[model samples]
Target: MTGATVRPVAIKLDDAMKARLKRLAEARQRTPHWLMREAITDYVEREEKREAFRQDALKAWEAYRSSGLHLSAAEADAWLEQLEQGHDIDPPPCHS
Candidate 1:
């Protein structure tokens, strides 16, 4: 962030919320601005990761629909079990 340009954005909060933020900021020995920035950053990062996972699932589903290739639940469970048992293993091949 050292070289990045930043702009100020204002948000309106109710009196109770503003007081709470101020108290929390004082307890944490931080500015209310810092707390707000951290909260927004964390939320954005979590949402981005969630979106990426959703996209991956959608892509996998599309691929499976096109190729009709997939593993049964039992097959996937067995592979997962082997990995959980400390065995280095590859996933089983997909089949129609």
Candidate 2:
């Protein structure tokens, strides 16, 4: 009802996987095509989030290596604990 026309996608699956998909769709009371669409949407969204997390970690690692600026684990944990307790706490400053 979004007024978006549905486009058709043709996929080829091995016989075993095809049978499994049919069983899952039947159990869910959905068509195999609907199940496939839902599965792809879920997978893409999950992978995109994972990719963003990986990129952020890489950037953090590079920054640390280049500047030697970081908070010790204990300091970081203390800051996090305070925040979790709803305390308005600033993060500990990074240092070499």
Candidate 3:
């Protein structure tokens, strides 16, 4: 490959696990190294996805804190019931 870097590293695994990996690799016509690389890549991608979701949750929390929307549990329920009954209820005026 052009300008691609490759490195060799040793890993330790149990005999049975290594045997299974070898069998699966042969069945898929791939080398153990290739399968291990693919597995690591998949793991990295999954972790990145989890991190992104966490970041999104944090952003949502920040927006919620800044949106000036506040309601107690009873007030929220009352508001929901009002909407269910087709009654027009206005939100409290924003102090700021």
- Candidate topping TM-score: 1
Overall local distance difference test of candidate 2: 0.95
Choose 1 or 3, whichever is better by lDDT: 1
lDDT (tens digit, per residue) of candidate 1 on 1-96: 798899999999999999999999999999999999999999999999999999999999999999999999999999999999999999999999
Candidate 3, residues 1-96, lDDT tens digits: the string is 479897788899999999999999999999998899899889999999999999999886786689955566677787778989998988543332
CA shift of 67, model 2, Å: 1.6
Number of clashing residue pairs, candidate 1 = 0
Task: Pick the winner on lDDT between candidates 2 and 3.
Answer: 2
Q: Model 2, clash count?
A: 0
lDDT of each: 0.99, 0.95, 0.84
Off by over 4 Å in 2: 1-7
Off by over 4 Å in 3: 1-4, 69-96
Please give the lDDT score at residue 44 for candidate 1: 100
lDDT of 2 by residue, 11-68 (tens): 9899999999999999999999889998999999999999999999999999999999
Full candidate order by TM-score, most accurate first: 1, 2, 3
Cα distance off (Å), candidate 3, residue 34:
0.8
